[model samples]
Target: MNVLVIGKGGREHALVQKLSESPMVDELYAAPGNAGITEATCVDIVETDIDGLIALVHSKDIGMTIVGPEAPLELGIADRFHEAGLKVFAPTQKAALLEGSKSYAKAFMQRHEIPSAAYATFSDPEAAKDYIQAQGVPIVVKADGLAAGKGVVVAETTEEAIEAVDDMLVNKRFADAGATVVIEEFMEGKEFSLMAFVNGKDVYPMITARDHKRAYNQDKGPNTGGMGGYAPVPDVSAEDLTFSYEHILQKTADGLIAEGRSFTGVLYAGLMMTQEGPKVIEFNTRFGDPETQIILPLMKNDLLQVFEDVLAGKDPELEWEDQASVGVVLAANGYPEAYKKGMPIPQINGNVYTAYAGVAGTDEQLVANGGRVLLVGAKNDTAPEAAKTVYQALKQIDNNTDYFYRTDIGL
Candidate 1:
């Protein structure tokens, strides 16, 4: 069957690459794909262009469509496809509120009794500011709507928290997305990502992955989608994984079903291993970006089959390689802020796999086009070994000073 993968980032590139390896997929196509996705035919339709995408799917006879990002899902692309009798691997718009609206997710968690930090939603700037002042220092202020993973501010002081509230609710930093905000007490712990393929209440968890959200090393700097990630995190014990599945993932799935929104597709739990156990920091309705880059390489099962089985509501037998994989994102200079683009990227020669997040021009002459340029992934017997191999491959790229990547990945 021919498969079409949506989105135009590193996660989409990784999905395209993985799906290309499936024997069930005779042909693969990507919408607005980047330069690193050489394994499939790239289409010109933007991910959010539902009508354009539907036309492309019919024109190409795409048997199944898989969405890679949250934006298209929030735009109800899956609903549109279903309305046309097309098969798509994504949750519906009503279900996508798990990621689209912070306040909604917080309330959902509360209703389900899911373990998460206590938070309060506010629309008035003064009310939010007052809540912040009462909550004291070291709080988390989040825009109620999507902000490309940068709408959250982890403030360390009352002044910082108030400033963040004003920026979101008063100053309109994120516009309507920030008109309402969710402020919660900051939880201190190590965070990890747990993604699962879901078909209603049947959830199949993938290998654990820990992503470096901060831009610079040692977990310092502003978050920029993700800087790097590694799969099968060694520190996350098997017992903890089981607990997360029973208390968090399963409950979340059941809660969504009870709420009359049966979620199908990826359910990503951004969990923090606090003193109270694994508590959710946030939830994403689709695959995590750099985390997908690392996790897909370790998946031994056919991804196409997995998607088909989930859509059919059948239990899919998933398998993963024991090997560890690490991915490091190479971003443009001054990333998470203003940065230059179109810088020529010299060819990299190594065994590493490259997934393009942002680039322009043809494959033969690629140039940086976004904040995160590309991700290089490597697999080995251990996480550290994989990180070493990935970093070694990164050194082969020219103009190393022009791009920045976290050096402490998998350490």
Candidate 2:
């Protein structure tokens, strides 16, 4: 099968790499792929640039295309691909609203009787501040739209809460995403991720993973686009996974379908294992980044087969190795904020290394392309064992600065 994967990030790179190894795959291509990916798979056009992608797909006689980013899905790229007679592994624009708008997802969960944290949405700065003060601290303030993973501020104190709301609503720091805020009541517990396959109404869970969302280590820092992740969490427990499927994930899928919206591709459910059981933290329409880097390699079935099953509207039976996976992301210094790009990169080690090509420059000398420049992943039969394998594999990259990765990812 000829597969064209959209996006150029670590996730897309991993997806392309995995598919390229599949016996079922005749050829593989990544759109505007990074330098590392081009070595493994053919490179196409830009992911966000739809016309270029479509033209490349058609010109190359691509059999199927998989979108790896949310921006294109939100822009209705799947609709366009469907119109062009191309098989795309993603949801429609209407179905994508579940991730496009924070408020919409919260409302949808409520309507579907999905368990989640209680909260309020506000547009007025003063009212929001008053509500925060009245509600107390340890709450969450979120930019209703995407803010590149830095939108949600889990304020630890009343002062921080006040500052967060004022900064978003009054100071206009978040601008468009903050225009209409979703101030959710913070639910404290162990947070984990559950990603599954969705072909219309059919859902098939891939693997369980937990991601370190904080930019720095010790789980203390602003939200980032995942610093690292590990699969088959020892702490997630068998009971917890089952409870999540029954009380959380199934409801979410049913709720979305009930709204006359059927989802396809990946369904990433962010859940907090609260005392009341698992409650949804949020929903991402596509696969998680660092999470994907780890999970996809553990899949025992052909990547093309799983996605083809999704496209054919079938609940495909999937299998995985009895192992865990760990992936660590290396980001440019001062990421999720102002930072320089196109700096020479140092080789880092790992079992599989992928570059996002965030910086369009020479690949021979590694360059800082995006906030997260590279991803290194490893797999083992145990989470702790997999984490150590990841660390050992990273020795392959020759970098001086001890790159950023969460020490407590699987702890």
Question: What's the CA error at residue 410 for candidate 2, in Å?
Answer: 2.8
Residue-by-residue lDDT tens digits, candidate 2, 1-411: 778888878888878878877787777888777766663454646667888888888878889888888889888999899898888898888888888899999999888888889978999988888888888878999988877678888999988888888888888887888898888888979888899888766788877888888888788888888888888666777887887877667777787787888787788998898888888898899988778887888888888888887778776788888888777777777776777776776665545554353545554665676888786677777777777776776655435452455555554
lDDT of 1 by residue, 1-411 (tens): 999999899999989989988889988999988776788999889988999999999999999999988889889988999999999999999999999999999999999999999999999989888888887889999999989988998898888888888889888999899989999989999999999999898999998999998999998888778998998888888888999999999999999999998899999999999988999999999999889999998998889999988888887888889799989989998998999998987676687888888888886799889999998889999989988988787777545677778888986
- Which candidate tops TM-score? 1
Query: TM-score for all predictions?
Result: 0.98, 0.94
Model 2 CA deviation exceeding 4 Å by range: 39-44, 350-359, 393-399
How accurate locally is residue 309 in candidate 2, as Cα lDDT from 0 to 100?
Answer: 78
lDDT of 2: 0.79
Cα miss at 78, model 1 (Å)? Answer: 1.1
lDDT of each: 0.90, 0.79
